[model samples]
Target: MAGILAWFWNERFWLPHNVTWADLQSTEEAAFPQAEDLYLAFPLAFCIFMIRLLFERFIAKPCALGLKVQANGPQKAQPNAILEKVFTAITKQPDEKRLEGLSKQLDWDVRSIQRWFRQRRNQEKPSTLTKFCESMWRFTFYLYIFTYGVRFLKKAPWLWNTRQCWNGYPYQDFGIMFTHHIVTVTLITFSYVTNLTRVGTLTLCLHDAADVVLEAAKMANYCKCQKLSDLLFLTFAIVFIVSRLGIYPLWILNTTLFELYEALGNFPALWVFNILLVILQILHCFWSYLIIKAAYKAIAKGKAGKWNPLHVAKDDRSDIESSSDEEETVPRSKAPHSSISTNGTGGANGTNGYLTGGTCSEEH
Candidate 1:
């Protein structure tokens, strides 16, 4: 197999200046990155948290305070009841139809209706604590998601490779794995959208959650402290590798590919599932390849500073895209509050409540 692959590669690559095979092998070994002890990430994350505390206290806050950026403060902005009702209605659904309804109800012009609603929407925006909590929760979630990815799946056979998970037939179904994936995906979408308002309510919770916390932390960077991005990418990358790249393939991919076959055989439905799962693995490898390129570029350029945290996107578009079928267009209820801000004076992250995060994350 190795000989076949090498011959195939040699033919395909058609080496520059007709470089010899031994020379290529030596170059490959020399260029390979040394593995770092991932355990060191725990303390490194702590150090990052401390750096955030100081930066917020000394830098972000002071700058905001100096610029006098607090608008309307924590105290609620009072509008008359009639106008308040009109205003609240618009913020909930900012549309011409809703504005017209308020105009007809309040006997106001459409222009007047629009103006009051706009002012009120801006004014009623949640407290900084609301935004802080939102970002903080998201930051925590990303970390948790990464950690969770590593935990249950690590012990399973497939972590090492795809072929292992299917070695035996009719494997026992672990109740926890089934519950976790469905529940966690639901929670992340809900959390991302809801935090746009203020933390609302929660009936149940997931055991562990980063994509969450790093989000909150970056939202804080909206104060023009964009350096937070590098710190977050660094902190989150370690756990992301163990969980996303580490266990997910072995656990989810293997089961979907090999193990499921034992129970379902080669049914059309099973084949459909298998094909999609294989496609997903192909995408994962492609994304990982892109991430590797980004890492090499980060090092080649001076932007990486002294640290190089190889990133893994956990930006599973398939999972997210699938959720769209389950989630509603507009949530019937206001989401759990962790206030989201799109204001330039407020922060540099998010489109409404969904932070675009950064160029790196968005690419995935």
Candidate 2:
């Protein structure tokens, strides 16, 4: 509770007009969580998680339905009582050794145990509608926060002059900007940790990258490095666009299709990070395909992609493995595809697991 309060209200008291670093550290000065204190994140994150749950239940889900985005599939896995108990007791992600122990104790083979776990995960995965709601929540938050930040600082004397950012060099810290930096980082980290994704991994990382760069750059600007800050914000904006729209579909889609063969040639010695990067790239392509299709529709028919998937609800899309849901449909055609599908199936991208089902031939 204290941590949750801090996430929202701490900044107000901690950083006031013309506040300095010493004001933060000096017990004789201002009040609140001490400067440099970071232990508050755990409770704050937990509270955010709980808030997400409540919002999804009461707010996001209802909105999704109104938008006509219903996720269809088996609601839950009918695992045995023992399986259910174990599933609830253990962490969602278990290490191999623990999984092995569970397999033996449950008198099940490793493969069966793995399958059960996968199904359980699928059951817990949010519906596409729910995901849309979650996104709306974030969009609302970021838009508000960014707007407020700009409004608050736009006319400041420092903003008009580049020299203000670098006046005192690197050691300076403006209380408000400092507080903003911490809060922004906490929010982004919270978002990343809360999401359950396999293919969306790279997108998340890229988002983190873009957000961190922008925030840090702002901090530098506050610290008197306006020139450097401008460069960073510009860079951040470009990367965000490219990563979200351009590279995600065009570049990543192409890379996933062509790079797999190159990767396989040295499969035994493949770079771990490179492999992870490839997997993430494929996932980005999967999600962004909807946006791409929407763009195509708008171009072809005059309107699309703004809110179709959440509202139209015809793709039968796979929320977990996008291939499974198919909530919206686009023209199917032969194009290069990736090995990973929205549902971890090969059919969408190829005909076999880890193979391009139709090689980007068609999409939903």
Candidate 3:
């Protein structure tokens, strides 16, 4: 009787204060021996951290190493000092006004300036694989905290043991799980159809190139940074296109397959439903194309070079022509002209007339 009373007191008061895996397991073992399976449930925080770490170490790090090699390697050589200068300038002038001033001095277009500003404001703007890995590390740290909160609620004996927890309330958890499953499956399908994995890999390369360009812009008094930012923007645009065109169709196909399986007994009804879904999917594809087209047009305007996927073109010719055109089109105001008029009559006879001469002018 004493042990039972003590256990009840511990569960109500002490359990809440010292909530841990061990404490949760002990409570489950003592109160509901048959419910031992629940005690084995790991915290969501653990899973999130583990996944984040794995992605950072396995995926992001390798990409960063490859980028470093490319940047330093013989094929494309860039001065280290120039790169450092550009990065330093960006870091020092983190504000938009400073960026604008820098852009004007560098002769970069507004679109490039906007892109640089956007990147600076983002919490995780990874230009290198190393930086990406670091960002992932930070993201995982925050994700762990978020998961910890969820796990806390799940593990709380007071909540889980209550009758209110089991009846109909668990539906919310089911809904969340279902949504997560759907999103994950959709993303996976999108990855396969759009070849997003390949694009994502390319993005890492583009990001590195942008970083180098950013660095170059800072060193020289030019709009070179704008070109880098534009490249990054273009990469994002391509990724968006892939997601829309490739992924959406796969999603429709998946949904159709599901409906077919669900309505096996009612073939005609399933056929009609499938047809409607197909129409809706086609509409969705059209809408996605419109959005992608608009975005592509917007980003393309800021491009500095040929922007051909299969070609290596330089921006030098266009840049030189634009610079020359700017010089000719924007007229320089002539320096203010100063005029003076003086008259002297009969200086020898000044004693008699006492003539004086003065000059006056209006200033505008």
lDDT (CA) for every model shown?
Answer: 0.39, 0.42, 0.33
**RMSD after CA superposition, every candidate:** 20.3, 18.4, 22.1
The candidate that wins on lDDT is: 2
lDDT of 3 by residue, 1-364 (tens): 9999666434323221223224323342242211222222344445756776788778756754654411121111122343235555664223445433544554543333333332232213222233335443543443443354345435533233332222221121211111111123333333322212222222122223222322222212112233553454355445444543555345434533463244222323334434554674576466546545544654567534323211111211111101111112221222222001001111223211122111000000
Per-model tally of clashing residue pairs: 32, 31, 1
List candidate 3 stretches off by more than 4 Å: 1-45, 54-59, 62-66, 69-131, 134-295, 298-364
lDDT by residue for model 1 (106-185), tens: 55444333334333444444544334434454455445555665575566544455444334322223223322222223
Q: After TM-score superposition, what is the CA distance of residue 290 in candidate 2 from its true location, in Å?
A: 14
lDDT (Cα, tens digit) per residue for candidate 2, span 56-93: 78986676566555546324555468767777888353
At residue 238, candidate 3 shows an lDDT of 53
Error of 3 at 276 (Å): 15
Ranking by lDDT: 2, 1, 3
Per-model TM against the reference: 0.38, 0.38, 0.24
